[model samples]
Target chain A: MTNNTEGRSAFISGGSRGIGKAIAIGLAKSGSNIAINYTRDKEAAQETVAEIEALGKIAKAYQGNVADFEDCQRMVNSALNDLGEISILINNAGVASRGSLITDTNPEEIRKVIGIHVFGTHNLCHLLVPQMRAAERGDVIMISSVATESLSGRGAPYNMAKSAQEAIAFTLAKEEKVHDIRVNIVGPGLVETDMGKRLVKATRGVEDIRELDKGSPFQRVCQPEDIADAVVFFCSEDAAYVTGQRLYVNGGSF
Target chain B: MGELDGRKALVTGGSRGIGRAIVRRLASEGADVVINYHSNQKAAEEIASEVRKLGKKAEIIMADVSDQSEAERLATESITALGSIDILVNNAGIGATAVGRPHVATASPDDFYRLMAAHAFASHDLCRMIVPQMRESTRGDVVMISSIAAQSFGPTGGTYAAAKAAMEAVAYSLAKEERGNNIHVNIVAPGLIETDMAEMMVKFQGRVKDSINELAADSPFGRLGYPEDIAGSVAFLCSERASYITNQRITVAGS
Candidate 1:
């Protein structure tokens, strides 16, 4: 494994399962200690902690809803206290959009989706950036989606939230460049995860998640490992000079 | 130790400029490379010698990438010589200034076609020929060298920008099409790099080094991008660390 991230510590929101969990494991393999933030599912979060500890790295799990600004501060403070000077912060906690179209979707549903994705990302970056900036070696990553580039009619709330998240990332990248902090976004396409499963069920009304896999040239759904790898790359020394970039781990789908 | 050790790479236009840097960088990281050139066998051979000094295998092939038959032949020959191609970098193309500055009305239609053939068609043909063999490998990567002109083009820069835009479009499609096959495709778009091509562009614009440097100073990095800057990003994309990264475009512009 690349030692690019060795001796670093990362705070990954929603690291209990799915793409977030995979990123935690990937970072662990790169020799970084991990602080995982999960809203619920203590059992799953503990499982992740055990796996990281087995890898001979310090691991801790914090319960917090990132959508709430106060909870974000609590999570970041807890992570700093547990892990010491957090160098990497990944905004990965997100909720799937329920409504397919803007007109048909309830305003409350749109608010919820935006609250978790946009507000959650803003909360984490707002609270944790000061410490990261002080460290002089920092990485702030936003987990976005390829849907921002899509012209598809459906999934309006999801697309809007992701677009806003990317805007924030790009803006931070420029604003934080003087501080030697690298800010970027990793946008993943359809992956075989809990969110992916829900996305398929909601969008295509398909009970079998396999249906979405057929559209991909690879004839399979994107693995969470794929997204994790991209996230790790962004955090690694290999990308030290790469800033204000958006890397999509969509396996070639637009 | 380099992260790309034991990999076999083929870089088109690997004789000089960004392609040469990529070839050298990959070799330093433990990958054997095939350097492809159109009419610069001497330069290609020189780079090959340099790669060999890095303790990796290096071979040179002469082929006009824009020509379908030549590109197809090069792919087949490269695979046979290197056993397999784990990474392919499509970096061969004509300079935007080569056709001279002319509006669409006065511009030769043939020039636009030539640009398309060199930038877009060549990449497509090579990917078609090489992807099958690449799929057989555990990890495969393809990097297309595009330009920032694709995003912002001047009046006379239409052909070059259009061709690059088309190349990017192809890259995006190929990325989705080949993801299931365990192949990762990406684009590296450079902005105002200090290369021979950039030199020609500067001369065409009647711009001197002082003016260019002033422009560079205004950029985030306070300088023009170097070939190595682009090469380093390509190297990262080719490594196992970038395994989950596919269908992405990383612009190596200073800003």
Candidate 2:
């Protein structure tokens, strides 16, 4: 295996911890200067940078909410300022909640989820895409969910939002082909991470959900690093000529 | 410039063997590779170290592919993390006889069907949902891996073969339907590979008699295909190099 991030730079959103943090570290380990974006985890973000620097690769923490468009733009611009142009963007930042049933959910809460899950993702693409097109080569990946397909319940708003984000990703991949930017989606099943554990708890409350799991006969749930590995592959050359596709990274849990 | 210089690919079930070889191959060519596994984040990290040695960026992901909701989440999250997905390798599959339709005569029917649906049919379901995007943008290619079992017929191999066959038919029909659109869809039906699954098949009930190399040499190629060998074929199909190839099955067997 060869590490080519040597001269490359990558800027990823929601990259401070969890799957994002793992991906940042992986890229740094591969030799790319990394720009880690986080909403409020300053210390965690710095720690991620420290890890990247430890790898002898340059890393900078870019603070911003993954919920705001302006923040997304600023985050991208700042990363470019520090590391030239980003060759890849891993959209790993996302949020999950304990609330269920949209009828009982607050409107503000819905906005929070949609803003970070969808809009924040959009903001970065809007700014970074043009530069990638100009370069005639770039990759755009959207961190999606199995909820969009398994839409079991109360995941309604979240599912719709992710579906919309996927729409934008496909649209960009289709339209941007003239410039050669590839747009794709990565779908992962349950992982053992904070986000995944939260879901396991949310639905494990239901008999059918638990039964569904056993019925599937899957192995261990999964981990953040698992999802990050998928990210690294999507950004790699092996996937060249692969565009406008969604890669599901679940164990046999499907 | 290969359409993938700045591109990224996330291959689930990618690790030592086919997945690992895929990571090395992709990274060697210039695109970054993210190696994913179910339990071995350490192995994933080690694979990361290997990919790093190539100067190509690599990441490790532990997301399980079967959890439907998580499936969508992971896909979206990855798309966000990398700017785009030029290739999607739905290589994440499990080989299981424990939960299968083995024609055991005593095995429960449900176990048989579920086994096929989970491993063989699932990836197509993924492509069914994910390929429209690929179609919408640049030229898209989906390489679904199937075993010679997909059509081997009858008895203990019932469920696995049926499910794989179903997926391949789906891939072939879809390939034919989308051929005009330039969305290339193909299948690599590996008769005998060095994977554990192959080893198990060879040992199962004397189904494959002879040593691994003895069986491998049975193929027209005079040797068994390695993961890297198959990886090369897959990468080519996804490259501009195979622009004219679509809707076909390329069987790798030694003569």
Candidate 3:
């Protein structure tokens, strides 16, 4: 509803569905054109583009695997060509690790999860940050998880990947200050997205996330839009002086 | 209409410096405010007039919040004036230089207690008195204006750092305790803003020969932070845009 980011464009990885889609829409609502990146689900990506277009903003979908540097390069070039110099990068693509102890987990599963979360984030930043440095201002937001804080057992891959992502955020925040680029981490707790539902169903044996509301802070599970709100804030001018900060959107609970 | 239209707020130390900037920023966002000051009635009234010019109701209340009885009275009087306080900003505190920053070994217990009472205990008392009523409102926000010293704890800053650290602990705990009640508690820790307090600190430390301007020229942004810079983050934290954020510290230090 606020045109806080007017004339700016954002490139959001894994923006076809779930939390990524919510962030794409939130940025659009804040008056930024969008380039949505998706590895699969072209239809979902197209639908998101249309939704953003309906808001009177430009939107396009790019197919890319963020884990691969070449794919990220190609997508970044295509997105820049279509969207005209994106200044906001939302590294929201992530994969959950299978809940297995390190001893029982297959090494391949660990690699795949880490590749998607850690390497994917690095690939995007590597490709886009140079161009971002030239812009009047820029923002990079990492959609991390509270797993970094809990470091819960049986999810070593997820926790490690998010921690590394935050490490990059803090490091980049310091390095890019001279360029007027702000890097921040938005860590969400259990949310009501596809990934969150699967996590809850797999771990807690609950078919409906609402059933866990009694135990959750604020008597409800976090929503994808709730996480999106934080991303928008980090990108807004209201946060112009804030950088290298990590805001956990877990309703004040662990 | 502004995002905070019809909301009521009470800002401590609202007479000057960062507190004045916060009072004006919040009023501009459509919240009627009560400006709390200890000794600067003129400055408080000036900010009140500025708030009134923004088409929001503004009131000034005088109380030395470091004193428990005065803090209690401030809360009661503020609630009486504004009907209900949906937003509370704990921005009152003495400067590190004012307290004469001393190393841990040389710091007096009296100085430690004085700093603690002014920053940590004052915030704790106000939260205790006002947070219960905040629960009855649709939304509630409490922001502690902390300092980056809480983390740095640099040399000769023991008392100041301890006070800010204690305040942060209270804020983090209150954030969790009131989450179920729809209240969001956050801390905004500023780094060396260009305020009278900062000027005094810089002068007292003799960091520069003449002015903070010389120091600002060498700073990261090529300029020292302004009170408005801190106010921006505070305004955002109190807005609906930050509804999902709690128990977080946003350092407005131009990292």
| Cα lDDT, all candidates | 0.85, 0.67, 0.90
Cα displacement (angstroms), candidate 1, residue B1, comes to 8.3
Better of 1 and 2 by TM-score: 1
lDDT, candidate 3, at B94: 94
What value does DockQ give for candidate 3?
0.63
Best by DockQ: 3
Candidate 2 displacement at residue B96 in angstroms: 33
Q: Report, to 2 decimal places, the DockQ of model 1.
A: 0.36
Best by TM-score: 3
What TM-score does each of the candidates earn?
0.85, 0.53, 0.97
- Classified by CAPRI criteria, candidate 1 counts as acceptable
Q: Candidate 3 at residue A157, lDDT?
A: 84
Per-prediction tally of clashes: 3, 108, 0
**lDDT ranking from best candidate downward:** 3, 1, 2
Chain B TM-score against the true chain B, each candidate: 0.95, 0.83, 0.98
lDDT value, candidate 3, whole model: 0.90
Regions of candidate 1 where Cα sits further than 4 Å from its true position? A1-3, A100-104, A151-154, A201-217, B1-7, B38-43, B63-73, B83-86, B99-114, B128-140, B173-184, B199-217, B222-224, B236-246
Weakest lDDT window of 10 consecutive positions for candidate 1 chain A: A211-220
Query: Tens digit of lDDT per residue, candidate 2, span B51-149?
Result: 789777777777776666545655665556665555667666655454543575665777766665655556755665556666655666677777667
